[model samples]
Target: MNIIETNLNFGNLTKRSRTVRAILHHSAGSKASAEDIHRWHLANGWAGAGYHFLVRKDGSVYRLRPEWAVGAHASGSNSDSIGICFEGNFMTESMPTAQKQAGKELVAWVKKKYGFTKVQAHRDVQATGCPGTNFPFAEIANGSTGTVTPTPPTSGNTYTVQKGDTLTAIAKKYNTTVDALAKASGITDPNKIHVGQTIVIKGAAEKPKPTKPNGNTGTNPIIRDGQIHARNFAMPGLGADGIRGPRTKEAGIRVLQQAMNRDYGAGLALDGIWGRKSEKALGRHTVRRGEKQYMVTALQILLMLKGYYCNGVDGHFGAGCEKAVRQYQADHGLTVDGIAGYNTFKSLIQ
Candidate 1:
């Protein structure tokens, strides 16, 4: 329940007109850290991490962006809403018990702070599959202050279909049979029920017992030690040791740069040097001549990903890079400045 201040360098904050709603989102990636997300947002030309708060699987809530500033989570709701993102791809995995509790507590905290009543999923505001289907919207919406329990029968006696919901699943949830549901709701085509479709349950079932807490919950390998192990595996010649000395550190970075080029087609030089070219390639910023950074290399890779014919991920902001930028800008209806600025980077990352 403790909120850890990340002290992230978010630069100047943009004042929000008002806070009306709280938006929930998932990272869509497992074992993500606040620093990792901050760097990703920075690469995308955002001032800092997009979410006002980030909750980890271990129930650790990190204050990322300031609550008073406009966030960049939902497309159109940033100005009036607070964004709360949790780690894990809920699309493919159920939220762990700790994360679930933490999310509810965080929502409650936001409610108290902003005096907001509505909590919405990311997909509720946009066309993207963010926050994912497995997100526990009902548990959050009803101000449930405890761990996830079996949802009791609604007083209204109607159930709405959600994404990834199946008739069999609904029947199981309501302690009834699909045939009974079909008969009660006159659902001739049980499979045709779409999201938001209402179906009536004949009668309320007995409340089920609360499930036991999972002992292995919140055990993410990537956050534990897998990332270091993977890095070691990637540079086997470095003895797979987790030491970062001056000699081994640069070599490891070189190996990573090469790996990005080989795996993601980053087109970085095979040289074992962490220069501006490598920085630009990593989506840090657009590089200019006499300035080498990893962001330039990232730009080149993004251009290549979009089918713009960049010669290589060389980390140089040259004529070819400018041309590619201009082409991308024109295609995306951005100002054709032949430079990758905030808008350009946003579009590229998106």
Candidate 2:
């Protein structure tokens, strides 16, 4: 649940708007990072990366655009919703387990923070197969509730090992003892199993009794040794699809204004409009070879926080700053372009 904050400065501040729903999108590309997506958006004449957050394949979360600023994601709904994009083309590949878990956790956090009651795929609002059909909507929706019903084990007698799996962990997941599992699998050493190795489990024909809704059947839900599953009680207004659309949008302009004033001391009036004074106070300038600005100072601070040594947090984007930016981008799997454009700015700020 570690969130890296990229303090991205949108040069031209769009009027603060309220968010009423959370939209899910797939990168539609393979193995790209948040910085890569940000660069692409900039090339398209966008302020920066459109999504408020980006979830990496390994379940790491990176903040792209701030929630208060209007995003450039969904065409007409950008002003009234938050966008979250996952890294991968779901049309041809299933979401990896880590990514799925991270996505669900992020969606749940957004719902709690913004009081958003609706969740939809990109195609649900527009006409495109962005978040492909292979996207597990049901599983993600169910995950938002903070509980998941474990699927019953298959009738097969053998299980293949996956990455990061071990005999002890697998045995615990299947509700069996490690010694028994090793004995059944004919392994001379319990720790000798390798990835993709098939291990046999005894009693392949025995099925655990089913549990009744009221717990009156005397049988409990099958529990894996170290896994926990809790029954999900239905909540009012949330349908079986786990969406409650058409909620009223709350006025959040004041929230944004207050935050700006406190953080940057933008000297803006309490008025919520994105007027000339407010825009000037929150103006963003590009940091390059000879540029100097308070925004660059902020970027330096963030870069240092991310463990990239930038020499000093001065208001200048010089050779040192450029070197730090390049290193950060490379470490995060972004293209090694050294200019502090939209993508670089977003990553540095976060």
The global C-alpha lDDT for each of the candidates, from Candidate 1 onward, is 0.64, 0.59
- The alpha-carbon deviation from the true structure for residue 169 of candidate 1, after best TM-score superposition, in angstroms, is 50
Q: Considering every candidate listed, which one attains the maximal lDDT?
A: 1
- Pick the TM-score winner: 2
TM per prediction: 0.42, 0.43
RMSD over all Cα atoms, model 1: 21.2
Clash pairs, candidate 2, are: 5-350, 6-349, 6-350, 7-349, 7-350
RMSD per prediction, one decimal?
A: 21.2, 21.7
Give the alpha carbon lDDT tens digit for every residue of 153-246 in model 2.
1223357778888988877655567787765554557887666455654322133323346632211112110011001111112212111111
Looking at candidate 2, what is the lDDT of residue 326? Answer: 62
- TM for candidate 1 is 0.42
True-vs-predicted CA distance for residue 218, candidate 1, Å: 37
